[model samples]
Target: NAGVTQTPKFRILKIGQSMTLQCAQDMNHNYMYWYRQDPGMGLKLIYYSVGAGITDKGEVPNGYNVSRSTTEDFPLRLELAAPSQTSVYFCASSSGLSNEQFFGPGTRLTVL
Candidate 1:
């Protein structure tokens, strides 16, 4: 049912380039989050928003930006991407009524 979807499953960006990773959910979740996973490490939260027009930085929000304009869409933007930004980005959403979260396939971005 495509509970959640992320575009450009894989991408390679040159240093200093910029791109946005798109994510959407059809479950009408109220909480959305963006996270990055580096090699051999656990997922690190990048940003999160409780609802539309509300957002807050997470543990690793240094080079990323995010916006929740609607309950369905939450996109992550990387400006002037650097080598350190190369990793897999994931988008997740939760109904806020429980402790469970639904995740997308993830976007693997490589900043070369």
Candidate 2:
């Protein structure tokens, strides 16, 4: 089964535009998360969901939103993109048993 997948491996967006980053996991995990990594910085959690219909904002959720209507899918929406939002975004999932998360390849977004 596919562990996790993210669409649009790379994207270039003009400032103030909007986009949605898709994420999917076939592992039936109970928890899913969205993270962003900036140049020379560590990964920062953007949003997370504990299960279907249960979602929460993470450390950096200012420019984004998320919905988890199913265990396999969690999509992140960028309402109004900004240059500060330019980073590599990663989707992750975990069964919550061992508390280890499996991450997707990542989506590189550039805002000019």
Q: Using lDDT as the measure, which candidate wins?
A: 2
TM-score of 2: 0.97
lDDT of 2 by residue, 10-92 (tens): 99999999999999999989999999999999999999999999999999999899999888999999989899999999999
Q: Which residue pairs does candidate 2 place in steric collision?
A: none
Candidate 2, RMSD to the unseen true structure:
0.9
lDDT of 1 by residue, 8-28 (tens): 899999999999999999998
Model 2 segments more than 4 A misplaced: none
lDDT of 2: 0.95
Question: Where does candidate 1 stray beyond 4 Å?
Answer: none
Which pairs in model 1 have colliding backbones?
none
Worst 10 residues of 2 by lDDT: 92-101
